[model samples]
Target chain A: MKLTNSMEGVTIVETEDIKAKKPVVLCGLPDIGLIGIIAVSHIIKELNMKEVGYVDSDIFPLIVVFHHGEPTYPVRVYQKDNLLAIFAETALSPESVHPLSKVIVGWAKEKNSSLLVSLGGIGVPNRIDIDTPRVYGASNSASLRESIKKYEIPVMEEGFLVGPYALMAKLSMHSDLPNLLLMAESYPQYPDPGAAAAVISALNKFVPVNVDTKSLIQKSEEIRLNARELMRKTSENMQKMGKSQEYELPLMYV
Target chain B: MPAQKRMPIEPADTWSYGVMWDHISGCLEPLTEFHDKETELMIRIDMPCVKRKADVEVNLTEDTVAIEAKMNRVVQYEKWGTFQREAKFFRYSKMFTLPAKIDPDHSKARFKDGILELHLPKKERRYSVKVE
Candidate 1:
């Protein structure tokens, strides 16, 4: 394992020696509704993935998270078989987003990852009236787009995507890596575990993961209540990143 | 040692002092959003774990709104943090000072999917003037 602590800002460190053949990289960064974080955390818990590494940076929050009687970094990497997930337990500041995205894509490129999937949520005004939130897909690769179509997930044709996942998508566009984003319609300010469940179900269709959404649905209320503080902090960060732009239409539809 | 440089402070950034829970009352502040429209100001509050709509209580005035909801069951946190231990929460409560004066008599509310939406009509009406 090559442990390179970059001088640029963010560093991806490998605490345990890991070797996987063309692993699939999954990102569960904090965003609107805390969708990605919730989904990835559930996946990590259900699959019993092991923590192999963590992300360290001076720009990150100056706090350590204690889990299961052990102190861990806010952002950590977990692995189960060929699946690799980067999960962030705390809300990231807006300034650290660019360098973090760069480091993640660069590391994925170095690993020769098969695909990079970003799980997130899209805020919708009428989310209260909808029982089952719909998931949308966007990819930089043609084959992935075909796969999305094959899976019958709606494609996000045109709109502004603002946040870390958006930056990762743009950065990976210039590289050979294939990046895919799956976002579910969710509440703008509240933690929506239902939306996270929807995204996970959608991801299960393409990714080789056997996970059920029934437990997620049954414990939706508890998840929302437990995730309140993170959602509040993430909402404030979203305001800093101009997340409302996602609601605006593209200037040129053609 | 070199002095650390601090980021510029903005008004909105300092608005929240980061206190959203009360240990004594065992009540939490729910996530809320406000939208200012042409005629009415809309406010939405997310109250998860609230089983029935009747359990929610809303009190409105000309320029303020208060909401309280009872959870379906008491939730116990074995470890909330280093400072808090075995905390129990049974309700959600919050109050907001509105941006504009609202006609409390004409305001409407709807609760669905654990979300409470309130439509408050502005007290002052806009009149179209004839151009000479």
Candidate 2:
């Protein structure tokens, strides 16, 4: 592996050279409910995307993901045409989130991507009672917010977003990069493919991926069963990161 | 000044591959939540493949609860990871210990949308005091 130290304490290795003008970057790091990982993985599979690169850091867990008898990086970048996605298959340590987010956002900016989209979940305690989870949207730029309105998605008017996506949004704002965060109501400690399907449906409205989610729904149980261990590890990491802050009422709201 | 303790080091071969393999291939332990309420302890288990309440079996005591639920069918994966073999799982099983004493007879449960929720009332209730 050709490891290049792009920034302090961060190394990125490119497996293949990618060339796309103003590509849309998607951040699907493992987080609450593993929604981002599930959605982005599904999208990559449905689009037959290929892995282009990976990000590595000393602070990350000492683990590697093995896929189809081939060893692969836990956190990888995949691309198909103009759509580039960064996803982590393994649970990341809390200490790595900030630096990782900065690297991802900075790298996307360097690539001159038109937009950075973050897919994630908003944990809902009563998720079991809801048949179809609702998707909420938040953007770092006014034009993207207008695009969200044009898509007719419910805007997250007022709330604190915790975890990696929050850091990415903050960095995006500082860099003046348009970013969108699409989150769905999900079970706090389980993989919810139903929520993932809902998020992808909303994404289709904006990106026109036209990917069908019926298969995702059909395999929801299997996904939930397989993702339990990762969910457990991610839950521990989330606790370390103080994800409960998402539920707290902001002092500025008063 | 205090010196930091050095971490232990072991040979790479000392780690048991079987233990790690078994952990990776073990039966699903349904994600659960335990909430301590004023009057009761609420436990919620997310078991997605369970089709009906009949498929679930719950054994409860004053301080512990054991759950076993059979899935509607065996969930199988082919060529999983480096194993390159088929793996099949049929059920979910887990046991949890409660923090406080619970009244087994007074406990109530409801299963909906593959989620099992149990409300275990505490044996002793706390009386609240109003301050002047």
Candidate 3:
């Protein structure tokens, strides 16, 4: 519970000492369709990961997530072996996206992580018609782009990505950090466990987590029902951040 | 100084799934989005666990739309948040007030993959004039 406030507006509280050989840093902030939150949460539970640290900031909503009887930070860091996952249980405001992304990238660099992966969703209006949600990959460096190609994943060649993942990618690039963004086609304002499962399946190809997605698919309805509130709040924040820009074609591309 | 008539400002409906008592009421409010298009107001509601279109009921007025949907089965949660008690919900209900007047008679709706989309055309059409 030792909260160390940083000038970046994010306070990281490390409850346990973490030691690993080039761990992979995964971020699952509340974004479109709650894809990151659902995907990372499922991975955390399935892997039985332990909470190592938590991030707090004034820009974040004043709320505490209660699990069982213990009060937990809304944004927490969980780790198992060499894999570290940072996820938020609540929606984040637009103003917090930049500072939080910078803090996370800086922390990941300090930890000497091998790769930073961001799980998210690309909002598609026709997501209802889509059965198998497609995952698109975007990278910060050429090496990561080559890694994405090795997996046969479609590269996001042209589009504007907004929100936390967008900020994370930009900051990671500036820091010379290898960052990977996996986004699935998802409803803009609904909790999409289906899309999360698709992303997790793609992630297992590279990360080797080997998590069974059958349970995730089976419990999709329940997750959607339970996550309605967070999805609503996240959708509002997405609108404020001009997330619709992602759909518009960039003039530079033309 | 003339006293101006005050137009009523409708409060936006906030839906959340964090309430433990939401299930006890036998109904849960689904998350909804209302978009004001150029010619129509599009309303989308997330109503998962609904098996078929027959399970959903939508009622629309000039400025308000009400939705009630029955879940295929009782959704039970063993422990929600810090609450240790079990909770069960069987239905989803919500009402949305649009910003502009709509033609309820011309409104059309479609339900697919647990999402209900409503297209309500505006009663009055908007016109643009070209600059000379």
Candidate 1 lDDT tens digits, B1-132: 111112233355464346576655788788787888999988888888897989999998898888889999888888877654788888988777777889999999999878899999999979999999
By DockQ, the candidates rank as: 1, 3, 2
- Name the regions of candidate 3 deviating beyond 4 angstroms: A1-7, B1-24, B76-88, B100-106, B125-132
Residue range A1-254, candidate 3, lDDT tens digits: 55533536787777888787899998899998899999999999999999999999988899987776678899999999999999999989988888888888888888888889999998887787899999999998898789889988899999899988898899888988889899999888889999999999989977999898899989998899889878877888988999989889888834
> For every model in order, what is the iRMS?
0.9, 3.1, 2.3
Q: Candidate 2 — which pairs collide?
A: none
Cα-based lDDT for every prediction: 0.87, 0.83, 0.84
How high is the TM-score of chain A in each model?
0.97, 0.96, 0.96
Q: What's the lDDT for residue A140 in model 2?
A: 83
User: Once superposed on the true structure, which residue ranges of model 2 sit more than 4 Å away at CA?
Assistant: A1-5, B1-26, B77-87
Model 3 lDDT tens row, B1-132: 111111222233134323312644767777766677789888777888998999999987887777889999998878754446787888887766667888999999999888999899989977899999
Question: Which of candidates 1 and 2 reaches a greater TM-score?
Answer: 1
lDDT of 1 by residue, A93-181 (tens): 99999899999998888878999999999998889888899999999999899999999999998889999999999999987789999
- What is model 2's C-alpha RMSD? 5.5
Using TM-score as the yardstick, the better of models 1 and 3 is 1
